[model samples]
Target: MRGPRRLRLPRTRAGWRRLTQAVAAGCVLALLPPTWLYVTTGGRAGTVAGAPRTDVAVVFGAGLWDGEPSPYLAHRLDAAAALYRAGRIEVVLVTGDNSREDYDEPDAMRTYLVRHGVPDARIVSDYAGFDTWDSCVRAKEVFGVDRAVLISQGFHIRRAVALCRAAGVASYGVGVADRHDVTWYYGAVRELFAAGKAALDVTFEPDPRFLGPKEPGVRRALADAGRRPAAPLPRDAGR
Candidate 1:
């Protein structure tokens, strides 16, 4: 059998220039999504103290530990509870994964928030928020949230804000602070790739994993807080 041909680099000057240009173009293409996220979410993310007063706050699930909210998730819930206690937000929409019977992120998050002083009645659970995009879509479609303050770690908040806005909920983001640990670094790197998926999600505006019938939880929670709920926006109103 003949041996395989050896790989070779471009031999001519013009060929080398073309190769360099191709590499640069590839880099630019890879960077576009993250750049879009940063620019679109500028001035929209801040500490909870500076977050805009919205009727609802949406907390995305991070993970759970021992059937409880993980430290990162607890920090998120803490911000939601603080917003409620400070009268900055009326309802806490805890959106997370509950696809299995044994692991329930939304319930764990709700329990943590309630323990931190948020009333059970004021917290709504979204059992199908399997990801950031799903949470945003469900917040608007199922829960009828026209505007909300999204909560997540700093590395992930810009993408959350971008996706929620794309999903038709006018959103401000409150990025919870955490120690600069290994998980923090991992999350930061993960956002670079997640941004690409986020760009596709906004561009296509696909349906979420689950788009069930509309729920009255958010409207009822607003009513309980003494605000007359505005009519829910049409599904495509954001576009």
Candidate 2:
């Protein structure tokens, strides 16, 4: 004899409508954490001029133009350099996508910082910060940074701070004021979904694309900058 008839979900028009509404509600619920993160993190992002000093300032990459930092990236580097010069942060960790041989974001960032008067010795390059998640994960797991100030545009700063914290870095942020032109519009729109993705990433605790042996780069950079490093917490502690 055939097994008991398989159960079937409602297939009528009204049933489908209910199912759709339920799915939509679930999606909204999934977004609430990130939305709350964007709200709560507002107070944490300050200006470079007023930010509290930290062992390092982690500057996330935007993009490059003709082998140089794009205007947005330049703005971030400018803020980081200003902080470094002001002695607000002991070292600068430039993290970004350098997955391709030809395209190098960390190098461009370091070069820009150096040209702006930041000492080369104080700059640490992370060649595998393929995304915000990767950068934060590697910052703790690979570079041995515990506390840091994250630098990025206002629209992107909140999520960066949250992700870095989740990845086990005690983090603050310095928001580079947006130009309020096309770039601001684009960044603001993109941040909505980026925040959601960050929430999911934190919950999942996925490993970074690359995690080599822990190195002394961050500690050495901080020492060179004349600051003793804070003892790092467990990599999975925050999450």
125-239 per-residue lDDT for model 1 (tens digits): 9999999999999999999988888899999999998999898888888999999999999999999899999999999999999989999998898888897443332222343
Using lDDT as the measure, the top candidate is: 1
lDDT, candidate 2, at 181: 94
- TM-score (C-alpha) between model 1 and the true structure: 0.90
Lowest summed lDDT across 10 adjacent residues in model 2 is found at 230-239
Residue 205 CA displacement from its true place in model 1, Å: 0.5
Look at candidate 2 and give me any clashing residue pairs: none
Q: What lDDT does the true structure give each of the candidates?
A: 0.89, 0.85
